[model samples]
Target: MDHMGADPDPDGRTAREQLKSERERDARRRRARRRFSVVGAVVVVAAVIGTVFALGGAAEDEAEGRPLVVPANTVGEQRTSVLYGKADARHTLSVVVDPRCAPCARMEAALGRAMRQLADKGAYRIEYRLATVEDDARGGKGSRWAVNALGAAANEGPEKFVRYLDAVLAGRSGREEWDGDALASPETLLGIAGRVDGLRTPAFDKAVRELTYLPWAKKVAAAHNQNGDEDALPAVTLDGSTVTVLGDDGVPVSPGEFIRQVRGDKG
Candidate 1:
């Protein structure tokens, strides 16, 4: 009856075996695909994490590298009084100064170098408190603008601010007509600031041109007058005590003596 060709495996064992092999092959392919997907996802996540960390590190580095200009004791809550030198210094020399005042200029010319030396030696730290008494008294905005400019330069860094202040002081003779007119225009102030290294940044220039710090300057002056004698400019204080340049003999101390007195080396 040709049974050999009709029913080679009565239970269909060959077909069953082929079906089982196909199922095994399919299972292996699915496992390989799942492993590949998991590995790819892990790699993608690692790459994204690595890129974020690299960018975050670069941003931190940029922030740390840029110089900071601090405006202390102004209208804001983050006010700082450190114009120069270390904030945690043992001795503090707080000087209330007017940019347009002749006496302030003379005081700076005499003691500027010495004060810087003292600060460098870590003997004392200097805090320059800005005041616009001259402008208020003169009925003009010159002192305010000048102070604003100085404050703007301060944004560059304390050293640049000091340099800008020095440049302004150098051109003054204490007379209102000369000092006021010389610094009346933004161009004049910008010109002076341009000479100082790192002081002529776009932000600084914008502040000077737009009078961005005028409000802060006004607040500083108001605060100064409220705290101390309004008429006095270039007032020096050593360790919270007022230091008069004039000695017991009513004679002004020399620049060297001034440094010595500030350093507690009067002997």
Candidate 2:
């Protein structure tokens, strides 16, 4: 698989991470030269570097023989994705994201509400593809750990999972950038879970701590690597084609505009 975790940068960063960092620094330099002439350009560029779902124990977790705790109502051979919206909804909007990716956070901060409103209005369903590439890039396990926590939330049903997912992205953290150290902590995961109504149950907390869904999290990352030419994290795809949510000026098109664009672009 052509995963970002493949090639190592000299400083031990993964290729994607290195490239993303370089791009960001370069963008900053260019912005300074242009005297902040085009702030929108950076937003669009940052958005594309945003997603990943990659790793685990002994296959990383494969050799452990722990029972895979699949989320309820998810699809695919590995049961990847958190299924949301009406099954019969006329369209599917696939959103890829990662826990510690700063771009993913900004993407969420920018248009998450619009997407949810559309989903609620039956404009389209959403399949959240959570990635762990950030974990691999940084030699941290927070991405997989976060996904495992998500699995615990999903076990209770989509509503819990959805609320918990949003909370993890922003809930009580009350910040923009992700605190990777906090994400790596099971107690932090539990604390985020506590913000979701009825999600911080004993079983849910146990699963997050013990990583009952670790196997599935790995599967999701593997499948992510094997499947598509990754369009980037925090990406949006409709009818199997990538869609740009923000305009050239870096502003999100209104929810109405988004729907019209998707409808026009449907393959």
Candidate 3:
């Protein structure tokens, strides 16, 4: 009698394989989670430092219910990287964000909603300057994707930019991770650029190649991370002066109220 037992159930083999694969996958996931958690902790620490120093200025704004508006002239000819609306708005809001940072996405949504409201009311002259605060040294794929996407939108024009931003920010929570070609490819960035109407393919390709904002983005990170806080995204500056951090719970401050305050609206 053959001791091989006539080829034991295929189901058993399949189950064993599945179990082993699952264990390997689980281990990989665990390692990834650990890495992310470590990175998060470091970013959080940096954010705390930034928040503390930033509090000096922010506290003054809260105390006076007004912050000294730094003239755009002070920032000089350097156009801010994050412009939310048309270039010629009565008020310009400069924002800094990180793609993986949830709060920043919420702020983007709020700003979009606010702009839509204003547009519906025939008050669409608000300029938005969006900058990224991701440290290239630390941000991994998500940050790169965000930077590239932002550049893609800006190069294409605000309409496409806004649309794409809304899509990514809106759907960020469902995204599994920032790995693979989606975040890593220049072509992916260009594909996003292509979504913009009338974007010349050569220009888009050249823009990606040049990466004009790469340096500016680093500058932005340094400016925002002046005191080394890397914890928050969607740091907001109204009219190039006021800095508002998304509250601890991550709900954004009311965009309506912010606009009103910026406009000195009494009503």
Candidate 4:
């Protein structure tokens, strides 16, 4: 009794319904994505604003009265490990990173680029330290790799450490490893470490195994996370007083703005 002219086939109704369902599902995903983007943007803006206020010293909303950031100066602390810039530069960037956290890799890239740009202009130098956070739920193997590799690099020179670190952040040995074969084993890590100049020696391999510098590692971790010191990774302190930027929330504050504000650059 079906009207032949109204329908081409009996399955046409089912096919139309399926297509409608798929369309609705896709539309929901798009809406979800848009909402997330908007929320993320707002959070970043708020964090940047907070940074500007904190660094700029706008006393209008000074609730905590501008907290001070204490400098880390332990006997075991090396000059190169204090900040993330070239040697002999005034300013320092001590970055706390967890190898398992993907964002740490991104921040490392950004920080490296920032240092190169500054160095080219004779503006500033950054000292680097690869420290681990206690809250890092992962086995901290990546932190260990960084500490060991950096220690190896430090033995050779800061430049070599920087080069090796650049490789580590860029997935040179595969960033995502569940079994930890890429960085957990001394042989595998030492192989990569040997490629860096100054560290390709039997003595270098032995020093890495000895890990004489691990106490320094613990001190660096404590410096940033001390009681009431709430600064997080990707966070930059200017002149040991101002919190210029926080990378924890993915804000995109320009480096120029940061330098001008933190270094008191009039230009």
lDDT of the structure predicted as candidate 4: 0.53
Query: Judged by TM-score, which candidate is best?
Result: 2
Query: Candidate 3 vs. truth: CA RMSD?
Result: 15.4
Candidate order, TM-score descending: 2, 1, 4, 3
Cα lDDT computed for each candidate against the true fold: 0.71, 0.75, 0.53, 0.53
lDDT of 4 by residue, 143-245 (tens): 6545644565566655566676666665522454334424544566676665566666775676555443444444455554553444345444443554444
lDDT of 3 at 187: 59
lDDT score for residue 200 of model 2: 79
| Tens-place lDDT digits, model 2, residues 1-267 | 557555555577777788799999999998797866566678766665342222233333442478766878686566798888887888889988887766566566667777777788898888888888877777777888888888888888888887787777773224745654458667888987888888878899888877888888888888888886463556779968878876665455566777677878863
Clash list (residue pairs), candidate 2:
51-233, 52-131, 53-131, 53-132, 54-132, 56-60, 56-61, 57-60, 57-61
Candidate 1 local Cα displacement, residue 73, angstroms: 10
TM-score of each: 0.65, 0.69, 0.51, 0.53
In model 3, how large is the Cα lDDT of residue 139? 42
For this target, which candidate reaches the highest lDDT against the unseen true structure?
Answer: 2
What local lDDT score does residue 155 receive in model 1, on the 0 to 100 scale?
A: 72
At residue 188, candidate 4 shows an lDDT of 60
